[model samples]
Target: MRNRRPVGIWLTTVLLSSGTLLLSALLAGFLAVVSFRHGWVRTSPLYGIIAFLLVSAIIGTLLSAFFSKKVLNPLIALIKATQQVAEGNFDVRLEPRSKGEVGELIRNFNRMAEELSHTEMLRSDFVNNISHEIRTPVAAIENCATLLISGQLSGAEQREYAEMIADGARRLSTLSRNVLSLSRLENQGIITERRRFRLDEQIRQAVVLLEPKWAEKRLELDIELSEVTYEGNPELMIQVWINLLENAIKFSNAGGPLIVRLSEAGGEALTTIEDRGVGMPEEVVGRIFEKFYQGNPSRAAEGNGLGLALVKRIVELSGGRVGVESRPGEGSRFSVSLPMENC
Candidate 1:
């Protein structure tokens, strides 16, 4: 674990190891010749020639075995590891063998396997969560339909059942839309459409767009924005604000004040949304941006948990960063920093 300088050290090691093997072979051959001359090898001239051939054959066989163990064994291990991985056995890994590039390669392979294992675990958990979320709405709609078909409900009951069905359908539609958007952001490698736009005005529009939701909760707004133009994908950038603002409004306590701040800092446009809601613990804040990661299961019904993930993807695609500041019982602040266009 010391300073691993990849400066011809591995090559030097291979050369030294090969030199030792060559010296060993030469010593054995010299001993065979000396023995033959000293009658230590008691045999006729023709038999002596045969004895030398046997020694050479033994040496050749030993050399083959040595090379097979030193070089071919690691390669075989790698092939086996690859086969296991292809069959979804991410838990399989190989340890470092030599102090050379092969060693480094094995280390990287182990790390890759570890990451694949974790990703597989997360994917399974996410699929299960999605199934549960979708099943709830689907079951509701099915049950409502069945009840309506019975034709034993009053006019009010019929309307209520129909409304419940509509609500369930809407929830499913929202989930589908969010999942598709997040998928596109993550899986597609298309370049983002970029242009110069007034950053402060965009922030204002996001705030105004959610005016109804915030007003319904009797929340107060504290807006402080400055004029700054940023270069990025306008359409995607707008979703960032929408998600952040929606999150702020969603978690905020009734009648609490939400603070929005925009400023210029070190050649970047900084936007921060602070919500006086029930803040989360450190562990929850750390993983909130992960796909389908909801800090509070109690509030899971309100969202399908892809908004923050999409926000992160869009921000990174535009060469920016998103971060969070929060503590339990206090408020949470989500900050986005994007490079501003040279004016």
Candidate 2:
């Protein structure tokens, strides 16, 4: 339906003004009748002045009401359109026939809606990426298990198939852990309680914890932290050191040297785990912290691909950051930085 506000306002203004004029004319007539008899203020002149005032008021009121309606209508429509856009309904559009500032606002609203639509598409693509990552490991596990079960094979063949099944299972476990950790880190609140402690002591503890794995591979530890001491979350930093050291051990050549150094970098406590190991490619390095992302898909490593991701998250949660430097043949270095408290 067409807006009748302007029409109704104009009609009301005219009717009211006419009523005032008629009332004034009636009063003037009454005054003329009474004053002609009573002889007060010369009835003819008083009547003329009242009539002029009534006509002037009628014209002014009508003009004001009409102009106010015209001015406010576009503003009201613009407000309503803005509300719709804020509520995420970008489909609403004002008539392009609207002119001046209001028209420009409508044009900008349409542009913003188009940009939001594109962002929604990108969000969908991210979902698809996560789904595909989850699906591949699961599919591999299913196929490998099926082959092992329906097999008629010798001892060596059975062992090989079993190993394949185990590898797939490990990868799936890794993928699940990374997804879970990402969810936690994104939402779970951090809790850090600081106490005075030796920083190198925590590194040594992490090394001792991973001793069995290193012994199995016959790896060597070249530690350099002799007197470094500071304070932070001992448990969380332990995880960082474990992850970095374990990663170094996992990727190192047989009988390779894994060097861990802890020292002061500015006022921050710095630790570096360097190993003569197989290094990551540039593409993998770029996405190393992403969920369910395995840098090397050759299954040469025994991790669930969550180790480095977890390391990064834990360090960040502890008010620290982790970095890596590596090359194809050269070893990789994982560095961790944390706030240092004087001990």
Number of clashing pairs per prediction, in order: 0, 1
Query: Please, what are the lDDT tens digits per residue for candidate 2 over residues 6-69?
Result: 4554565567556755665566666556665666655475665566557656665566566555
What is the C-alpha local distance difference test score of each model? 0.84, 0.73
Best by lDDT: 1
Error of 2 at 10 (Å): 17
In the range 1-343, model 1's lDDT, one tens digit per residue, is 2333433544645665566556655666676677878988876545655566567657766775676468756766776787788888999988786768888888999999999999999889878978987998999999999999999999999999999999999989988888888878878665366688888999899999998999999999999999988877788889999999999999999999999999998888889999989988999998999888899999887888889999999888777899999988888999999876453
Instruction: Name the 10 consecutive residues with the lowest summed lDDT in model 2.
Output: 1-10
What TM-score, computed on C-alpha atoms, does each candidate reach? 0.80, 0.60
